[model samples]
Target: MLTPREFYVVIERDEDGYYVGEVPQLKGCYSQGDTIDELLTNIKEVIELCLEEQEESNKNLSEFVGIQKVSI
Candidate 1:
């Protein structure tokens, strides 16, 4: 059996009130849904599709340090 890989997901509520989820590690991996649960489900499917299209050369994902806010 293949070991499950863990990925970090970032979710936010957009201006239209939809929940948007993104996998920062996977470029262009994003999805949206009306609720958190739905967003999670949608993102999972998107991640799977992205993984399927991922090439061996693109498997080296960058390390996620952290997110910060800056005020002027």
Candidate 2:
């Protein structure tokens, strides 16, 4: 068994002032929006879609197998 991968994500404003989001841990996972709320919603949907795709394909979500972080 393995623990779920969780990492930080930050949304930034692009040249056209559009909200662009990226998941730091999941390479190439990104989304764009016209507003902050939309950006968050879009990113959530994107994450879900990515996870679902991995599940359907029977792929391990994370490429790493070692413990990333652990609580004391």
Candidate 3:
């Protein structure tokens, strides 16, 4: 059976003034653009790749319990 997975993204502006988007779940899945629209488009691909990676990784990790703690 197929399972669902989730991932996180972290976007920021760099010192050089470019918008940087990163997929934390998938290492090296990142992109930068001069504008928000471009960044979003680029990041969409980045996110998809991240999701694919998460699915691959889940093959080994899915058996373990998943938990998260956050403070807001």
Would you list the C-alpha lDDT of every candidate in the order shown?
Answer: 0.87, 0.76, 0.70
The runs of at least 3 residues in candidate 1 whose Cα sits more than 4 Å from the true structure, single-residue gaps closed, are 56-58
Instruction: Kindly list the per-residue Cα lDDT of model 2 for residues 1-72, writing each as its tens digit.
Output: 978756455778999999998876565679999999999889988887877776787766444344355789
- TM-score per candidate, chains pooled: 0.85, 0.64, 0.54
Prediction 2 global C-alpha lDDT: 0.76
Tens-digit lDDT string for candidate 3 (5-70):
555456689999999976654656789999878987998887677667767777322232344679
On a 0 to 100 scale, what is the lDDT of residue 66 in model 1?
72
Better of 1 and 3 by TM-score: 1
Measured on C-alpha atoms, candidate 1 has an lDDT of: 0.87
- Which prediction has the highest TM-score against the true structure? 1
Candidate 3 residue 58 C-alpha distance from true site, Å: 0.7
Worst 10 residues of 3 by lDDT: 59-68
Q: Which candidate has the top score in lDDT?
A: 1
Between candidates 2 and 3, the lDDT winner: 2
Model 2 off-target regions past 4 Å? 1-7, 58-72
| Model 2 per-residue lDDT at 10 | 70
